[model samples]
Target chain A: MSVSAASSRLPGTVAIGRRRVSVELKQFFRDRNSAVFNFAFPMVLLVIFGSVFGGQEVAPGISFAQYFVAGMIASGVLYTSFQNLAIAIPLEREDGTLKRLQGTPMPKASYFIGKAATVFVTYGAQVVILVAVGVAFYDIRLPSTALQWFTFLWASVLGLIACTLCGLAFSVVPKTGRGASAVVTPIVLVLQFTSGVFFVFTQLPQWMQVFSSLFPLKWLAQAMRSVFLPDSAAAGEVSGSWELGLCAGMLALWCVIGLVLALVFFRWTKQGTT
Target chain B: MSVRDVRKSYGDLHALDGATFSIEMGECFALLGPNGAGKTTITEILEGYRRRDSGEAQVLGIDPARGDRVWRSQLGIVLQTDRDLGDLTVAEAVRHFAGYYPDPRDPDDVIDSVGLTSKRRSRNEKLSGGQRRRLDVALGLIGRPRVLFLDEPTTGFDPEARREFWTLIDGLKAEGTTILLTTHYLEEAQHLADRVAVISRGRVLACDTPDRLGGRERSSARVSWIEDGVRVETQTMSPTTVVLELAQRLGGDVPGLEVHRETLEDIYLSMLDDDRDEEAGESA
Candidate 1:
């Protein structure tokens, strides 16, 4: 057969993207380790922390468990969307799977869209599960009003996009599949610890607080807090404010910056000399 | 596919130093060489996976350096290393990759063609080396590619599996798929390729049909026989003339008469040795 005859029959981008999503989702579900880590791990952490410090008040009237719920949700988004993608991309490249994909007719955008869809679905499920656990087990309140739900929706969307893009960008850091976890795990751990995922943002040291505020994780957590916590709980945050606009602005900025970084750094194959 | 004056350099090392070759449609051409002989460099260039520093390369009438998804869709590539899709079954992986192409073969048929029907449901990670190699071929063929690139496709296959793979490739060739293969296995080149290009040190020493490669057919043949209970052998350009003279002297069938031409491996080894000698002289 001639190349033109074959090329003329190439599948469209959308069809390929949809198939890629289904394939990626199937692969994700089959891997029990990743499924549990991305979905159950956040809820497990929420349970562990919520049980230990559920009674204490972090803010004037809000209990520690209620305050921590927002941060945990934020952490789940970052871990499932950003951290997972960052680690998976380099590992795939190292293992020649990315090269195989590159050899196909699928466009690069379709691959990323498929990956983004997988992250969004996984993180959406994580949020639902974590919120259910918080409301049932920790007596944490859900987003009550239309405005609160609206804030939650945009915050989750923006956070997921920023994190996933950052993850794609960071894929350049790991040279091999074996080194991906080593490179990505510590960064995730440090981000979680310092970005108020585990502790109150106001309580951390000034320098740590300032440093953490610069990252998307901190802004995401603060945004989530504004949606879930009562206005009175704002006193516990830095600047004694919810800073919803600032939160949205920072995430938007990160989205733009992360996209640019991913485009510049993301490679389908490992660096070859020739 | 056509490549002319292709050159790729990594730092001070020239991976491909002006190597050139071409393959006609429906032809199975093999780039035969040893490890580090730039067989992969040439294949990757044609596969559109890597860019050459300086070269002219056109695969399927398109410059591989600028090959897009549509161009890529027409090509099937099986890399030397295995591409395991984590926990996906062989069938699942094949089916998934099939969706990437416009016109893909039936996944089951492709799996069966590679003789992986029994292990279709088995996770790719669970497959043995040879089985995994078969899965690679299945993935490569699922797209119904016009041009296929097999890079050391049988590297990990057992002898039986290797022979099975040869038969599978024979089927592909019979269907008129344009195939460009690279291998260190001379026998594989001899068995599969319509033409074999002997590459060494990033250069094509010779490119011709397997029987004619390195002038193997015209090169001196070794004539051997038993004479008065003692073995005798002579290298002669005309084995027929030598045998005729031997028969005339013996006045009957020459005892244990045997005339042997060099195998493809012998010619290939000599080409590599000649490369080494030239390198040694250059260094001196």
Candidate 2:
């Protein structure tokens, strides 16, 4: 007998990708503890840092809160894309979620695409909330020109891709799910401190400035600063100019590196792990 | 599906040492063994979840190690132990899995078939052990799989639940779906399998119909009777001859006569013991 009454043609990747995204979203939001913490932590940081430094000015008119808003946007993208996946993926692996998916007919690419899409949606919402908070309470200004908005768009998307890939690569480090947050949160915290998300990049110790430049966070924050802060404020940056091209280039480069590392390190089953 | 001389080793431990078995279409084939007897190893290889060190294996006319997404869609797996999808409700999990197939059964129908319709709206973690297993079966059936792999599917089930699960599998067998089952329960194999392979020490010791596994049908039967206020018992290859001789000696009617043949469990245990003895001799 035939397998079924319906057509036997396999569903397209697009169909499965969309379904996966919806399922991922549902799973994410349904877990109230994680949903609350993941979305709230970044905004909470923006409030605390914005309040402490709201009165200071770095470029004659740009308050520290305004400056901090740019860094927070960059940092928010990292939280949603990198930190979230780094913790979540390992947990799924430990729970046999990845193994279950591997046994299915879903194309492997669609699984990653679903994750990327979920990151994009959640990161997009995070940016909106961060921008709204910046404008309402921190006296931060929105980008005035279409070019600035365009810059905002590309910078966020590139950073999200880079971080998401990096997160997938980094997920293999934690031996078990219970220890993932303990390991992952510290690395993200360190990146935030050194990458100008929590402090002015130029004022950080010279060694930190040199070290953070190698990673995506510094470039992401710099790119965000270029769009949100005035053109005149670019002089205050460590490079003495808004190196938009370099920001894009470094992030693009990290995307490649992250992809290669993820391909090499990702394990679908615990038995495959070292 | 067929496996020829499949071998897998973890360092010094031979998980599947040249094990071989072939399952015909529409057949309920059971792999019976004790723990660490390579049942899960061979099943995982056929499911494409693991690669064999060296051998030839295929499922649905394709090499499982190289099986692609389309090849995967035609198969279903109920794992030995998995706690995934705990966050999704029963219906949600079934429907989500159904979307992965090109042609899938109706999600609600599959859920009902597994007897999990009552827990449809409950989260997977909320279900009892037996209920969770039923949900696993629901997900396995949602894709209308032509071949289903059930690895110790009812390991934690109560006796009543096990019977219900057997009935469910019987229904699948009726529908002509090829089922590959691995279990420690000999009765489960006897009740559901068309054929059973008794595996021990990473080898196929015997493969035949459940009734004839390890020559159980031809093996000696115990003939016992009450004679002269004493109980008498003897094992014989031909119980008819022994019973007739006893009746003739006892004047045509033997009191408390009883004939007993070896059960599948008895045959299976002896096979395992013999295998262990062989291993001990080799090591010495």
Candidate 3:
């Protein structure tokens, strides 16, 4: 088995990829700044929003805190996948990490896989923490049925994939590590406010609703609402009913777009130096 | 490994213009050059990190442009200056790199070879500049590569540390690991290289053993003597003839007779100066 595997053209690809993921995760969590920003910031946002508007009802028999939990979870996935990656990737390129890895025998695809895995692990942890806080502090409701829980899992997976790919693609927008946050933060903040994460979709202006529909975050928010909110609450959506199928389709389309963009934009090193 | 007629350019500035050289297996070859002499450009092209606009480069019978991961596995490259792996401890970083190779040396042994065993548990960010460079060497060596490329490997090392590094490299050479080194330090080349190549303005000015580079062994020697309470110096292709004549003329012992052949540093500087003058004349 060892001889045959060694003779193959791409030997030990999976084993090396696993090693890369472990190394990437070790580096990511060891950095205090990344730990605080990617893991804790979203929880803080959820709490402040819950405290300010926890009691009011966005729909009949549904409290604002319940509705906001679904939105917060969706945006939290975006923060872990998109915002974190956009900053980390450029920083790696600037600091010679990518260049160092490029010289080694590790396969090129393994590097991106390592980064995606880090994002997934961090996103999973963030979700658990946010849900625990919502249930304990604000009495937020979870999916009540097996099918509802299945929707939550699938929606989270798709949303995370789309957001992660978008983050990798946007990594090239910043020329240096110092410019990464300045370039990526405003785009994420604007999307969150427009995509019904901070406010109800129908409550926003008509132009904002149309604009948010073009992106994945709006669909992610709607999918989370379908899981947590009662069926009657769907009447308050722009279409007056839950649109789970459309949400899945839109998120999947963004996944394709994001993958293409990432392939096109990703570079292993800074422009001039080898 | 060999490079022939390799040329690369950025707009109007030619980074490498038809630079050519070759290294024999198990031979320690040092590339000596002033800054911006295309040494880095050529080295990067050979390492498969940069593409040449036009040239042919072969390492271990494989074209670097077409080198795959398997091909890369056979070579080790130490970059000039890198701040990577700063978050990981020295041992962790070395062990992590060791995983990338098919057959790797023991990470702990490699770390000890680079003299970082005491700092094994310390984060790379806390290492001094010289220590960080040693870690880079440890990572490069962990793969037990057949050919090693070291780019200014001892830039930040003090004199004692540099001597230690030389001993380590000498051991690798004895083990038949081919080394292609680029450095600005002439004494380093004289000590480590079996043959040295001097590059200037993207072209090789001279290439030979340390004793014979720029025809140092055959060049004119400066012969000086004290006569009539005055020092007199003359350049002679044969210092022995001059010394014998001076002794005979002075009757007994010739006062303060000195014969000086050019040092490696002297020849290297003059070669660069001559290349600059030639380029200046052409442009003018």
| TM-score for each candidate, following the candidate numbering | 0.94, 0.93, 0.93
| C-alpha DockQ for predicted model 2 | 0.53
Ten-residue region with minimum lDDT total, candidate 2 chain B:
B78-87
> By TM-score, how accurate is candidate 2?
0.93
Best by TM-score: 1
| Candidate 2, pairs of clashing residues | none
Clashing pairs in 1: none
Lowest lDDT block of 10, candidate 2 chain A: A1-10
Best first by DockQ, ranked: 1, 2, 3
Lowest summed lDDT across 10 adjacent residues in model 3 chain B is found at B65-74
Error of 2 at B111 (Å): 0.5
lDDT of 1 by residue, B151-250 (tens): 9999878888889999999999999999999887888999999999988889899999999987888889999999999999999999999999999999
Write model 2 residue lDDT over B93-174, tens digit each, in one string.
Answer: 9999999998899999988888888889999988998898888888888899999999989988999889889998999999
Please state the CAPRI-style docking class of candidate 2.
medium
Residue A164 local lDDT, model 3: 92
| Cα lDDT tens digits for candidate 3, B113-206 | 8899999999999999999999999988988888999999999999999999999999999989999999989999999999999998788888
Task: Tell how far residue B22 is off in model 1, in angstroms.
Answer: 1.4
The top-ranked prediction according to lDDT is: 2
Clash count, candidate 3: 0
**TM-score between candidate 3 and the true structure:** 0.93
Interface root mean square deviation of every model, in Å? 2.3, 2.9, 3.0
